[model samples]
Target: TFHSFSLILSVGDIGYYDDAGQFYIVERMKDSFKCMGRQVLPTDIEAVLLSHADVAEAAVAGVPHDQYNEVAKAFVVLKPASQNKAIRATENDLQDFVAGI
Candidate 1:
């Protein structure tokens, strides 16, 4: 005698595969938030932040804003080598970087 079982699960993760059959996790579906009626992906912002040489790690999340309903806020950790550097990054610099991208 044999028994069969069926199972279903929803992980809420977004992913894609490359041409070479390499799998990549883009972001969590639930992690996306809206701002000004536009859905914003935290991973997209994180990618921009991580592009900077000074940024070692970055996390982005939605925060309440008086306008636009919500806005993206970034938490960044600087590279150890950058900490002792005379040239330091400022808020404007990060903002400008994101804006440029």
Candidate 2:
């Protein structure tokens, strides 16, 4: 709190894209996550996760965090090959890649 100058800011928390060539922010700031003190875009991470060979589909969501403010939680669907072979990427490797970004 800033002494003698306490204030609150309200901001959009959700976003959407339309076929009409427009995108909109639709939700609250407290619902979002900051990666490296910058907004960690959910769509961006979804794209990255889907790019992995073993991943068939992925959904990224923000998890509550006391330090990072928030962290990403990915719910993924595995490819047939990956499911059969049980192939998987190590958590360290994924974290390293994301950390590098």
Candidate 3:
């Protein structure tokens, strides 16, 4: 479909602006997962995971699901404070946090 070489190219990144007017590329169009008959953007879930004070880093990937075809599996690195014995952060607690959002 190309007659001549063109310098313009599309990177397929999806971006958005927040309330502060900050431009951020949340996810790449190719990276979106199909779940519940809809597209689930990893960055959207990552943003919510990062909102938690205990989570220092977060990553989401598509995993096989029986009903939805695919689901988001999150990997998180907790902050130093949360690692302390005084602060108890359970797997269920983190799951509930994401589910609440």
Which predicted model would earn the best TM-score? 1
lDDT for predicted candidate 3 compared with the true structure: 0.72
lDDT of each: 0.73, 0.61, 0.72
Candidate 1 lDDT, tens digit per residue, 10-100?
3344455565655444455577878999999888999999999888888777777878877888878777664468776777999999999
> Candidate 1 or 2, higher TM-score?
1
The digit string of per-residue lDDT tens for model 3 on 2-25 reads 223223213344455565654444
Clashes (backbone N, CA, C under 3 Å), per candidate, total 0, 5, 0
Q: What TM-score do all the candidates reach, one by one?
A: 0.65, 0.53, 0.65
lDDT of 2 by residue, 7-51 (tens): 232222445555554434444455456855878777788788777
lDDT score at residue 87, model 1, on the 0-100 scale: 79
Residue 73 displacement in candidate 1 (angstroms)? 0.7
In what order do the candidates fall by lDDT, top score first? Answer: 1, 3, 2
- TM-score order of candidates, top first: 1, 3, 2
The Cα error of candidate 2 at residue 18, in Å, is: 27
